[model samples]
Target: MHAMNRRLSMFRSAVPLALLLVLLTAFHAAAERIQLDIASSGVRKLAVAVPSFANGSGNPNSAAGKDIARLVISGLEFHGFIQIVEGSTNGADYVVQGRYSSMGGQMMVEASLLDTAAGKTLPTRQFRGSAAQQDDLVLRLVDALVEDFTGEPGISRTSIAFVSDSTGSKEVYIADVLGRNVRQITRHNHLCVSPRFSIDGSKLAYSSYHRGNQNLYITDLNQNRTTKAISRREGMNLAPAFSPDGRTMIVTLSRDGSPDLYRMDMQGQILDRLTQGSGINVSPSFSPDGSQVAFVSDRSGKPQVYVMDIGSKRTRLLTLQGKENVEPSWSPKGDKIAYTSLTSGRYHIFTIPVGGGSPTRITSSYGDYESPTWSPDGKQIAFARKRNGQMELCIIHANGKGERTLFRLKGNQSYPRWSPRRN
Candidate 1:
């Protein structure tokens, strides 16, 4: 009996030792996978510094230099790829400084990127523009620095056009990625929805119900600033998507009483109907190669994602893990699709592969995240969420880290679209 009791005591000790080993191995594996995923997505941010830029226009310190610095800082923050350290902090990886030379009617600005520890300059560029063109100068310099660090063009110059109801009527407003230079693009006493950018970023096509019915209208941003109705069909014209070449648009129309996806030319002539009797298909997005289309459909008894071949008209379901998913936006790289899915009680943003895979949740604890729009580089996602009863624009890394608010507008903001890099 004594020997048996001793054996039992040893067994209990061995059991706990074995269990601890298993737990440690599992934890290590999880950490390894997380690191691998972050590296694969290139989502790790670099710590950099941007002190107050100096004025070189003989003023030594002017508001223009500060304004330029502020814009640059905002651009970097919005991109979410670099963390700007305070001037008081040290031991950073990189430091950026600037000198703004005011040229009377024009401004000449030079920005330099330096290695703080090594005390070496990484890259430098100078930009010149009229004083009235201050925004342009700052944007150009910022883009240069971005390319130096990330090897890709910055989104500072990219614009976002979305619907706003601040005027008591739904209208479209265009602003930079930093939410500055807000401009009212449309002032009609009508309702507009689904605003999209053309390939050249010179025109916007949206569905407006101002003329007693929903119709598609194109606003020319370059010439004459004119607006023309592109489609006056007998049914609801909405959800316009531009082709990669910008010569065609795939949209949803309910003229026949059922929402269906249709491909049309830039002139609104119907070229093909991609879906027929699909039970409310909408929000069609073309692939970057212009070979396939992804949209939302409820033919499966619930809203889910579907992709169709442009030529064969064959369809396949893309998302299976989520109960209901909608608002599919294909990334520019054509690798992933971002959409909103309801998990728990709040809506969260998720992304899945285009070829059908388990969806990865990107947002959590945020209030009703929706309408995720990918950046032109596919590195970050801009989305709208109602936090504290106010709609605001926020961005997060593609790998579900570095979540930050872009800015809070005066009124509610929704349906953000990040333009292609201008530089």
Candidate 2:
């Protein structure tokens, strides 16, 4: 009996070590498979070639085929991790090709990724949708291709919410990441700003001044476009940020004659007062974890980014290099906070570590960039840039590369906020 007990104990001790070895081996394999190191400071975009897709009906020059290839290449290059080269070049690491066909108003597409050095092709992925959904189908395929190479999926289907004055008044609008399928969410005709989406992307909240006062409102995106006012306090109710769990929100309320940060439920019931009587605290952005929130405050005599512990309510300033910092946006990874900093009379996008460090300026052009919002994957930031007396939406990589205008619209657009990953 004693010998048997000793053997059982030894087995239990060895099992943990064996499991640890297996886990290490799996991690090493995954790291080797993905060649792109997203954290590296240097720009090392993977060289890839996306050839014109072929029509299965024997017409290689079909317009549908060309359209699909164009959309795929553009979507992949927008992420900043992959560079679409012309055809399969000498240094190209991978090649993407596909075939598409239309039948009975439905489109069928099949795409495959080829490993250049390995001289092999991955299994083909097939997609089917209405002919009008060709763009969406290609975007999904590019997302799948990205996931096949990297472990994480691309944000091809994500949308951006912003306040546009195209209709002669500031109203809320939503557009896809590629700037297609633009939809107006609010017809307030007055002024609407700070459009924020719930974590699940099913609801949107914004502050509108249409009813003669700045009031907070929520809209159910999944329902029949019902708009409900959640907070109509006497003073200002603006910049509502949904928590990570989507059950509560942190907003700036000035009902008591001073703009302060308050935690409130979805139904506009105040749960806890986060900040009171301090310098004007507004633009509250919750950390990825529900434990902390990064917001803009003027308590230090200048508007700067500050983070507070949700439980203890202890706050610490984050930006030190900028004179005035506002519109704090917490990254999805919870490592950095992106905000707009005033420099040389111009507002530019900058990011600072959550633990208090020197801010890193992201925009260097002759323009004013503001309202920085991190992508769902933490790889990019969408913001509003005013250049040459024109305001437009722009996106920049988290590492400060690949800065470009996101979309071209008729009128001015501002306060761009990226939605969370779709369900």
Question: Please, what are the lDDT tens digits per residue for candidate 1 over residues 258-346?
Answer: 76888999888999888897677777878999999888777886667889999999999998765556778899989999987756656
Alpha-carbon shift of residue 214 in model 1 (angstroms):
1.3
**What TM-score should be assigned to candidate 1?**
0.86
TM per prediction: 0.86, 0.87
**Which candidate leads the pack in TM-score?**
2
lDDT by residue for model 2 (152-256), tens: 778998999988999999899999988898999999899888888888998888888899988888888877274679999987788588899889998887788
Model 2 pairs in collision? none
Compute the lDDT for candidate 2: 0.79
TM-score of 2: 0.87
**Each model's backbone clash number:** 1, 0
